[model samples]
Target: MEETITPTRIFSRWRWLYRLILIGTVVLSSVIPVYAQSEPLRIHPALLTLAEESPNEIIRVIVQQNAQERISGGTLSRAGAQVTRELPIINGVVLELPARKVIDLARARGVRWITVDAPVIPAATPGSSCNMLTNPGFENGMTQWDDWENTLDKQISGHAHTGAFAVRLGQPSGAFSQSLQSATAGGTYTASGMFQRQSSNVRMSVGIDFFDSNWNEIDEVYTEIPPSDNYVPVSIAGVAPAGTVHMSIWVWKDPGGSLYLDDLRLHSSSMDSGACAGYPATAGYNVLANGDFEAGTTDWWLNNSSLQVTSTAYNGTKAIHLGQAAGSIAQSAGIALPGTLYTARGTFHRPIGAPWSGMGIDFFDVNWNEISDVYVTIPETSSYAPVTVSGIAPPGTVHMSVWIHKNSGSELYIDDVSLVGDEVPDAFVQSTGTNQLWHDAQPRTGQGITVAVVDSGIADHPDLNIAGSNNSRVLVSEDLTNSADKLKDAYGHGTHVAGIIGGNGSASNGIHRGIAPGVNLINMRISDGKGMTYASDLITGLQWLYEHQAQYNIRVVNISLNSTVPESYHTSPIAAAVELLWFKGMTVVVSAGNNGNGNGAVPLFSPANDPFVITVGATDDRGTGSLDDDVVATFSAYGTTIEGFAKPDLVAPGRNIVSLSAGNNATVTKEHPSHKVGSQYFRMSGTSMSAPVVSGVVALLLQDEPNLTPDQVKYR
Candidate 1:
């Protein structure tokens, strides 16, 4: 190596070693850090710029901490930062400090980022344009509400969405309600409010109750709000039932974490001006829970030990015994409506010379002051003699009580005591599963929801009239069939269908009520006498519904007819028309034709065979509310459709179902005179009757969940 060291070799080796040293120096330079003393290492870029512009300015900011790192309050206080809020939910803290201190604070160990604390504006009070609720914001301190006495401690400050106060529920046992007397039957109303919950387990519901003129509860509806840490808004709208003269809006909470509510609002589209057609059937229901004295003396106010329940039968096994003279037993029935008729009747029996006994009604004002009293003295007899007293509820009558009294020393037995209002519900409504809905805490009567009946026509019936107003619930009657009787049901089929959907049971004294008695109907008359119509007529009816769906708020369309021939749904014009409506967001319910003779034949129909629409079959509930004896009606079409789709989509009670009859002279009524129920109702057996039961159910579903689409309804 030493011998080869010439002048050229020494120059090449030294040049290569110098190149390697220069490359190493360059790499070392890239690894070294450049320094700027004033630059912020962890501060947000926007905050850094702001600090530069306004070093001494005070501002609010939210500082986020790194994982496993917490900004101690002592450190923040020492750095001239005023802590505003500790947000454990986001692992952050809101602070107010000088802009110059923000950079210093960000330079601390384990600091993440800091940004300006922007102001958050809450949403405007829902339904503010026409908020019917007084003191809706809770800023007025619980005034104008019906249950303020119970909610006095519930109202609190500092937790509102916008105002200074909100309703904070301490327990989930009761409700906060406000009675709205301006709501009219058939009028539409919207209710909304803002709510917040401290934990995800809390649940709440905003509800409305419709009451008739007699103060009888007709229907009730409820909407649930989603759980959220912060304030969220919820809204629901419904139509006042046919007999609704007033209503109440309320909010109820379920057990869990804390719940807060504010800005409750209610808006009505129209004023109540005698819109109710008649009192609801519930009006005539017995208000006294223990009128029969079967449950000991639970509801009765026993004035003394002289009164007791005995095995003296007037109607029921147990009756009330006034064993001592001047003894009295009373029960508070309910609130009374002015100008409404109330009947107090009871059966009384006494020994030959027993003290004179009487049963009567007592009316009281809001203060519980006795306003007036009416009594009927029972004739002295060994056997029980019936005594009755009836009168119109007087003005200023807020409460009613039924009392039984004895004048002198002797034993008197009383039984079958009843206080019935003018209207009563039909017993058959229970057979269709509607009784379950009626008895629900939040009953739904298809209020504010519209259903289209594209059959013959809806005739003029009292049950079809809107309660409290002089208007027909048949919002519109379109004659697509060009029949001689315009807007009238000459075939008696459409009337039956309409009645099944929304007849209020006003006739027959509420003994023949329909399923969804509160639903508004739009009659699209496509069939003439004898239930005859062409496919084009049905298409025209569907087109009309499609065009006016928004105007009428039509949500469900019921077609209880079928074509004369079976055809593929893909090519059938009627099927295409129904599908178009279904896609347009209308729940189309068609009846499986009455062609099945228990042979399990494929249905011969078009719209019913359409895969998109809801096809309904028929079942016989055996004239009972229990479904144990239910069987498919022999004529209810079943099996697969021509398009290879399984049908019908569902089954409902249809055999011998009693519904509205057009008249004695109507075609079906005249042909089937034996099936006529009185002069106002008809009993028919077919899938034509089954479809409307499902149609009424659809109306109820839409009333509860208005946002559901046709597909969603079908799935539900």
Candidate 2:
């Protein structure tokens, strides 16, 4: 320094020294300060552990007060506990620390803290959990707030946390200010949590607040919360205006002190969208079944060509085990175009664990080869499930075969098969206007005539197109047994009777037309497959027909089926009812029992034998009528009534007489084997097949004289 250096060099060196000093100061200030406090006393981890482990114990303090008085007057206590420094004070005793004392203690302990502004309440005991303190009268500090108490007595004590707390509350009158936070506006919100109250009578309220972008309170809502486990839904419409929204829930204590809440969560709106639509139309027709085979046996016609309708035994069975394989020709036979749509259906039920079983319908052409098959698999439930088949061959001379094959075990069943199509017109009487048989009189048009048909039921056949004036042709039909569900012909008998009485005037190949084509029919179904009908149901049906005769314009009643003659013919309820209807100017035409021999000795069945009923006997195509019938049908029972009336007031073509079935070209089986084909004109023999002929004749007569009484109509 003593040596005189150059001025330029000295100035450069001084500038360098100044920059170094400035950098050193900046570095020192950023990294570490000279006067910063170090190593302040914090609550010890051991003490915190002790406090948590034994919450009921009070904490004590021993402070080393420095000359700077930094640790002077230091105290230790639980945060929310009340505290007092006195000679009588005891250590490890739980007490509430006042707000001032808590702040003072925290400051002395070198910790920044805020005390709960409200009066401090002691927390629940160690190993205890409960809502210990409810709203305890912030309105009035003077009033006692511990009157109502929730005391949870320990029911089971084993684990550390098995204890519960006692909560107390004081009733107050004024509205309490509740500040809430963090709720969104214009959203669907559901607040649900489990809450248990010590007592029943308690009220709760949930408060919410909405804020704007400026942090200003925009709106507020208050709702009452019922004490239950079900979700309480609350909705907020419109926007919250983008600020901190607030929400708070409060319980208004009744006599009960506390309520508990657990598992609380909030959910946002879901963004899902979808729905349901509708159904489709059904598919085409099928052949359900044909009756030519035995079910559950090797006797299927396909396996055995020599199957005949004879008494035989197979598979350890005596009689024919046709089972569901027995086809009902009456129910299934029909006419079809070359290619048409149809469905055949039947039902079968078997016990649990039974072997697999199925039903099928076979269609045969004129040569009787299997052209098509409709089959169904049986389910092993105790209920009937419908089996179906569709798609059939065109109209021709065809026969159906129903088959049931069981792998093992027996089954119970009911068989129903039908050719589905638009209904063809049924055979009906054409108007020949003459009141006399075989006359060339002009048939009248549009004259109202009613024929009552009591049988299985009538199909809406095309041949019987006589609709009532109101378009309601079926009038006063009642099922006495409540068994016949609809006017469906389970047996072919009803259709035959209907065709004979009032068939529509449509015929195929000069066949299937009935006698009285113009008359309307009132269908009454009174029997099931057993060929039995209850007397009460029959009486009710007759009474209904009688009562509504005027409305229906019913002029004649055709009873094609007969039961065994009651012992007393005159006092029989059916006879009485028949007489009453006859007296009411309605003619009753009955079938003379087919039991009579050429000798006139056997009396016909009752109702038929009744004086008021017109008893009709049978005839053949030869026009040679029998004394009752030419040769009595073997199955037809002989009549032996005390009434000395020789049966069969007259005869009609019953033997091999062709008639209408329920549907077009329906097959009818009778005593004659010649009637088995699908020919529309079937050769049938029964008083059943005969009575309808007389009914049609009556309709023709009524067409000429509308007001004829029962007696006059019969006499004519």
Candidate 3:
């Protein structure tokens, strides 16, 4: 006999599954180390199978200790015979010791694991011997530049004498100097560069500062620069004093507006020097080392527990796969000078979004204090797209960090990250036409209409609240994960999805306002934070929504989550349940899933693939408001379902979308700093974020004409 299992029966099965997970957590917590909690032990598996075949006499390794125990100096006392050198402790002291001792160190007290610290061999620097000044071209940003006085602004720009970048000094007063460590006493040197006057009232000059054997400044000379937008070639000759021991070159501008400098060269007066090709003439080199990930995880440091090398690369043979947004595969870019403009580039992909995920480069000052950080979102894609973050590094900046971070629980793959001097942001979405379409509609903002969110639970965000009251517009929340837990969001997806529907943007000063800000919300949560959910739980949530639809004025239902079972509307219970809700006087909208955007023939997710429901796909709005730039989101599932219907009723903006955050402990808030829209707003992606947008619009339509049937709503 054909049978049916009601929502109550599914609840009983869920209780058992929850109990098993709870029991497993209690059992594992005692065995795992604290660092493992942040990231797992990354011990190269070959270490346990060590043999004499290993080359190299000495190898570098990082030893991590347990949380409570400190790694004392005597921890590796047995390895004294094999120890060659000791570097400063970062994760731990980088030790150059025999590879044979690795197994022995693994058994040492408090040692969690030993990781091979392979050194990154950078691309050779040409013209090293010919150039007397360290960082003469401003290639390493400010690696060798002196900025202790801190009177003026120093930054990197794309305008160069011959290359793609140059250093610019702005405002009041300050100086940038490169020290020539080695110079024969009494020797003559010539300093030449591309210079430009950019609004500074006072003249900018280049000169040399001579120091005697005792480190006292004994002599100084200067050369003046004329005002110009284009680069003006200038040079100055200086002779080391009789008692001079060392010298430093300086490019200075007095209090005024700005002076730009680039392609600087300091050489013995006898040899002639000129600007190299314009693209990279200043540094004439890429400062970011090993950016292609060709050497495995050699130069990249793991933030989460996993090694990053993957087969999904944009250019090279390998890439980095990331899980947690908390930690990232990070590497230091060449030194970045304060106030210099920098451009970052990379490619990222995630089939199932959390695309609030992004890669970023952070600028740090000479004192190692953070000056500024910039990030660019990685849209959900089966392939990849370019991401860029370009801005002027804040004052006192001397270095930068390039890392990849995104929404936690969302898997991300990154490849070919490089930070150069300058910026051109690839637009994430459009801003025009969207406002006009909604504002010009009848009934305005879905005022009295209510939407039922039958997926994840929404959080109590300040902007999502019903104006003055402490309660949120998200009403009647129920956590299907556990009866013991409150109807609140612990895993982060639902809050962001709901925020996109009716968030008021109170916290973000209206910068991230939702589609239907006036619509009421009823959160019926079924999924966990990472968005993992079962079909039974979803069916139950839908059934419960049916029972309580009258208690709340739920005119629209949004299901951004999906199931893989591709049964027809005639055979699928979930499809029948949603259709019943539609007939009961509510419009249902669902996500087409991420599988659609790939090149292969993608099948629609169940229920969404059903002909009746409004299955929404995603579109890349190109960070603009006009429809001219819009294209279907690469990850939104499309094509015909097994039910023989071409689905995805429509497309909506889903790339780099910003909305309200779910407070401090929320997943997206903690893991994806790159997606932070403001103190209270966040950015995310996917058809999951797209579906609610349609639901909100449906709410507005329903408000305009209250008695519209499901067929009428679909037709509209």
Candidate 4:
């Protein structure tokens, strides 16, 4: 107690310690950065990607309970967004909001930001798209796929080569394939699939099937899938047919077989996804499981139950030998899509020349409709010849019947059989204006959506790079006009519009191109050669497009016309039709008119004046790529219509745009001879050009956001 009474001495010592602590605090504060202490943005990672890639793009979003009210009040209502979906569960709403407003929604009251409605797949490799196969890895366990008729032995198990599960083909299985609806014919492609088998008794193979427009087999190539302890890989490289429209993958396993397959991938050299990056070649399967007939006639069925599965090998350990007169054997093929090409090849051995009436393969549809004039045969001879059946698959063909006619007691042998297919190639580097915008934007190229071009007509060209037997041009065509065929482009304007929207630039060495190069096109010819279009013809065309939108996966329609007489969309038939399309979940893009902006007076026209559609105006991007000096085109119409709604929902480049040319186009030839870029391309201007550019961007938007409504597209 007596020592504590010395207060002045203790205070002096405590002051020194306090001064030292203050100095240390100042020193530490100077070393640390303010950002290091700040909290990170509390947004989903994928949502953040939205901000970076497609800021103006509107998308669906899910929120927490009671968050709809706050989100709509704070973000949707303020931004004039329309709700795509409003779910009562968890009080959720799938709304299409501008990508920029995502953060605002995150900050709103009572708004707990759940993730995006769909998984935001990261942008793919700059030039490559995502895998196009459905149920590719058997993860969904036999969904969206078809197997052999003898499917009783196939098993879906967890022993996957890649993914959660794979289908195991055990003892008595034929080819397993899914119809490739979107395959591009004439494109170079590579295919690889994994297989696993611990035993040596089973035979495995892989192959590529070439199919024509009628699903007929054009040509085929087969390779063996090797065996492995875990999983082996097999692959084939080839070019698809110019007439081939689609294809199918065939996985075959020999009778009494046991193998597992997973991670089947088809890499397209045309789309620039050709690299296999350490793809396995050993222990992989082939296109034909028992192409050599070494598997003892397990997959080959006896039509008459009189054929012998003999060990009389023809370049193999086993072959099929006829046991009785008129005896036959056949094997079923994998189901193929319409317009695919395939080929069947085998060696027929005949030790004794017999009077066999017929020995060839027959094609049939799923309904068992046998096709005529599409088979290969061996004539009466003791010597053998390599027989081949190569032709376009007839329409509705699902199976190929290969059989031998054992006439006059002919002892025949068949061995070393195989089939393969492939696709054509397309070069994107020929496309001009394909710059950082596409690279930095969301990774999609209007792959799934289709655009309807309502104009004069569309012509087929290499620039279009269309898929299938059609060569990527004109999937569907309607000649609403009386002057020409569905594929005729009398005025050339329609072809120019189509080229700007989806030209892959096969003709221009990749110079002139469209926005969504991979998107499909539907041509609705509604005008005459002199560029004359009537309201009746236009309406009829629009009606046809609307009725068959589902058939073509039509998500967008492009109208580059104008109406001189202004009327409210509420009363106009054409405008009403546009509204119907919008309501039916399609984005209708119309030109904002090239009527000189009506001097800011009567600037609106027909369908473009409608409030529900996406009206596009034109901006001159100069001769350069930068937008720094961009200005609204003098001829691009803009202003409030009589209905009291201002328009030009979006603006895009329209000046001096180079696109596909309808050869010998009267209007183009007379008006713009000097603007030609190449044999297939010509330059044009106006809101007509701008409208298609916007339509293309809409396709890209729909690629990743397919659920977006027309109002959503307009708002975006």
Candidate 5:
């Protein structure tokens, strides 16, 4: 006898399954951490293992102590520990010591827990060296430096070399000074600053003053500056004297003249050892070390006990679990200079009721003082979602850190965090022979052509936001999904497709330029924010493009999507809609779908099955410039249509192609956080990426020969 199921019965069955899975997970979680967190012993098992196996090996560790117990340099030196970094945020010091001394160091008076010191990634590597002075630009109103004569006033309005403020000296012979506590005794330090003179006859002097253990000045070296009316930059190099524990940067003027100082800087002359190491050197745009958490909490700062690296992940083998009320996992690095742009991106998931969580950046001055912070929150979602925060570094920004933080809420899982500068890789463009074509005798760049992207909306990005003398590259931005008239790339697909077709590579400093970068783009958002669309939505977008083709010079129509079910091209409505546009002289490009089984028998779907339009398949170029190793992607569609017509007129490079990534909670970026190249671009595969390559070529052809019909252009 057949049985019928009601809603209550279905819920009851699902409830049992959910309970069983939850119980299994609970049991597994309790069993997994017993070895890693053998806590009652007051030391990590890894450290204990290192101490036993390699007693004399030098290892790095973070030493935490009781609140009342101060850990001075003398105390660490007594234990044979050399301090590497002082982290006052968590009241700890990062040190390197022989493994045998760690147990003795931990048993010291008022000792707290100690963990292995993992290396963190810097926001950027400026030239080669890193700045080490705080408030060097006087943007903080003279907060970190001391004025010897107390005759200085901060200039707030204008005449500053960089930011909004500068320090003005009233007394000519007076000086300003700041102590460099992190300086090395025998290392060479360089000092540079900007000087704007009120009178050209005055002389400016800047140098480094070395000091010994008793706060006594040992020796000094100075660099004299010639007079200049406009602000001029001058630098001085000095080697710290022997027995110098620290040094101070000094700036002074002579001959009784008013001089303004701004943009002061002090740094080591040579690059620090292993300063740019620790991160995955091959990951193109990832600047955070161990961001995937696959190596546990190696480079992350954990202040509380509730944070852990767990097995639950969005796109990798491991992810971070934040259980504390106000806990975060962060890694800090030294920045290039003020006004440099940075972006922080990551993914988060909540298993229970949603609460607030964020990905952010904490900006620091030259002395590692917290100057300011900015963040972007993830939406309420049970599944993983991407979040991005981007902005220019404020004045006096010398160091910064990217963090995934959460307030009180259900437990949150984070994965694939990255903090990177504004640049992207160009391997995909070079592999497709587009870069070589760009340098041809009479280079064609789709100057007068327009391409329409029919998928998710196109987001605003520096690469696609190009403008000419009068008009912007974006001709029209309309939504057929009925959500809004204007467009935003909530799903990130259309923006990537648009970038592949005509991005100018402004965000990447022209390294990742598109195939036809000068072409105009028409964003016809046919899908909803989550990339859910129907045949009706596609038809609506196609009809609108047909009507406005002449007005916008829309020579190419790119459909990087397919129908759910297969149908004959003669009967499918989407196929008819695309055929009408093709008959009207618009070149239509469609993705051949990603359901191939490598048997050459998979049924093709419409409008990909339509013979009138150009259907493109995808090839895996393996991120190289040569096609010698190219292969057809296993998932790329291959087959004959229902009516026995062979489809996919051409193929193009598509696997792991990097293109523009939408910023505001983009769906694909969240779904596959590992595919992100940097904050500005994402890597994706399938014929959806392949179709745009052909569409971009169509735009180039139309620009070179504007009189060609759709059929003639396709023939070329």
Candidate 6:
């Protein structure tokens, strides 16, 4: 190593070995081993480093089936070679040394070079891909930033090839299209995006266009976008063209303006679907406890004394218990009271042993005196029948007891005991009219006449019996209350009214016969004696009479009770309905109330002030003379509306008009002996006693001419 040698001799001795060693180093540096690493693969940085380090190295790329294509560009210059070229890298294939490798070899020969990963491809689905065709770089050869339009152009140019195309426009207009790799046929398609206009004064129309393979326009739809800060969802559904086609979004300006489009999507049809089916029935409760007496096991019988408790199968073949004992048994139980009248009703099954045995229920006052009694006698043959007893109670708490007295060992069954009282009729005993109408008119049977009786209720008194004729045709009968039972009177007002209208001279051993014994009677009970009825209820009663006018041969409706206008009257639906009834041909008679003269106080209340109704005033039965008989009663209200109209059309006899009361052949003593007529009658006063007098006259007129309208009847 210390020996000196010539430069020529040393170069000749080691040149070949040195050349082989350098080649080996280059080859080793260029080659790289394929190995899995924890780090994620990044192709751009790795490829750039390799290009810079070993210029002569052969570069290859391997990709998945759907991997993106890439492009690389570089410049090279050597003593004997100079090259500048850009090459495309196709994905999904292994590539050997390509034509661009020449630049790497040139760089190995000591040429200056520059390389770049070019042609940035946009991310896309396999069926649809994108690539940049060209890059203009910058305008004016300056590297300054561009506006939104130029930026968009750059982004579009970066991914314009391979069936994916984009473009930028300062303004959107007409229709635009781009080719698609594949198309759908007879499938639902949807496209959506956001569109905005720059000028507040301008409107923009955005739409999607579909084209066939031949570039023929197939379908298009347009939606409007206002020039405001709002993102509108514009979508369309239709069948896609067959084979490869194009889809485009376009916007047209009404007045040239700027517009924006973003967040675009497209989809197709999926599958058919449905939901569960069938109609379901509504559910409700049977309501077992709907006010059926089901408390204690005493069989709903209250025994206040020693008595024998027994059960009987009667109405509906249901068992009803009866408590029977001898010495004046008295007991009470809670019962339903409706409209002031107490009615005890039950069905009796035939006795098992003795037939002549009678079973009776006694209704007692608080002092334990019998007020009303219902009794039934069983025949030898076992039979089922109904027994009913109805009368007035003492208004408050009282006692009711059922009993059976056995002349022999006989059994009786009772069922369906019902008690109802509230708004019961006031007890009105009929006074026989002294002077009768001497007009030679055939006794009217009340077929064509309607006589509205404003009172408590009417009883089936024989002399005042205007219910059914000998031909069995009931002239009129209906409960004015909102209930079904029509035969019971709570306070005897009906019996008195009927007597005044048509009592047939039969009651309490012959005392009172009505004014017109031939007139048909309509028992319009408007009071329960304790208080006045609500205006709404009274209006309902009047409307009912009007509705049944033709059916019941009714021509007039009499409302003798009075009440202040309800708060609901000014806008009452019931009052409006009543007005409609009056308009449609019917005369309404209303009482001019009992309130006397007062400032700003009108005599008549509604149906009376109801404009078209015939308002009646009351007069005492004093004079048998001419117009002097028309003087209003002292208690009667004088008519003059707040707006001023002469009311109280005419006066009729209302004071001490004798009528009938409910009683059998026995004569009963009067509570006020001075008011008693002979032995079987009593006298009372009030407009309640006057209404039927006019109702009777109307009945007489109807009997004379059957076709009289209520107006005509009123005039007569």
Among all candidates shown, the one with the greatest TM-score: 3
Mind giving the per-residue lDDT tens digits that candidate 4 earns over 607-650? 77888888888775543343443567655668887657888887
Report lDDT (Cα) of residue 62, candidate 4: 50
Instruction: List model 3 lDDT by residue over 36-87, tens digit each.
Output: 3333322433333221223224554545334345455564655542333332
Q: For candidate 2, write residues 1-716 as lDDT tens digits.
A: 54443323333333333223211111112111122333222222222232333344333322211112232122443344443312110001122442223223433432211211111000100000111111221211212232222322111101111111111223332222223344554443333333343344656543434565454777655555455443233322233333445533333444333443322222223101000000000112232333212232222233222222322321111222223232322233433333434455555455577666666556667666657776767677765455666555556625555555565344334333334532122211222222234344666422478888877666555556543322434544556545534436544556667766665435453345566656778888765533345444455567677778888888888887553322234333355557667867788988765444343454454567676788776543221111221333322323445555545676654544445554432222332234332534333445665677778788777877877888998778
lDDT of each: 0.68, 0.43, 0.62, 0.61, 0.68, 0.41
Best by lDDT: 1
Models sorted by lDDT, best on top: 1, 5, 3, 4, 2, 6
Q: Which model, 3 or 5, shows the larger lDDT?
A: 5
Candidate 1 per-residue C-alpha lDDT over 105-208 given as tens digits, one digit per residue, 9 for 90 to 100: 76554444455443111001012223566678665456686553464236443355543346677654457789977566666788888888666666677988
Q: With candidate 6 superimposed using the best TM-score fit, by how many Å does residue 547's alpha carbon deviate from the native?
A: 3.3
Q: How close is every model to the real structure, measured as TM-score?
A: 0.41, 0.36, 0.43, 0.39, 0.42, 0.34
Candidate 6, run of 10 with poorest lDDT: 272-281
Superposition error at 230 for model 2 (Å): 57
* Model 1 bad stretches (over 4 Å): 1-428
440-475 in candidate 6: lDDT tens per residue? Answer: 354444444556554455556556444443431135
Give the TM-score comparing model 2 with the true structure, all chains together: 0.36
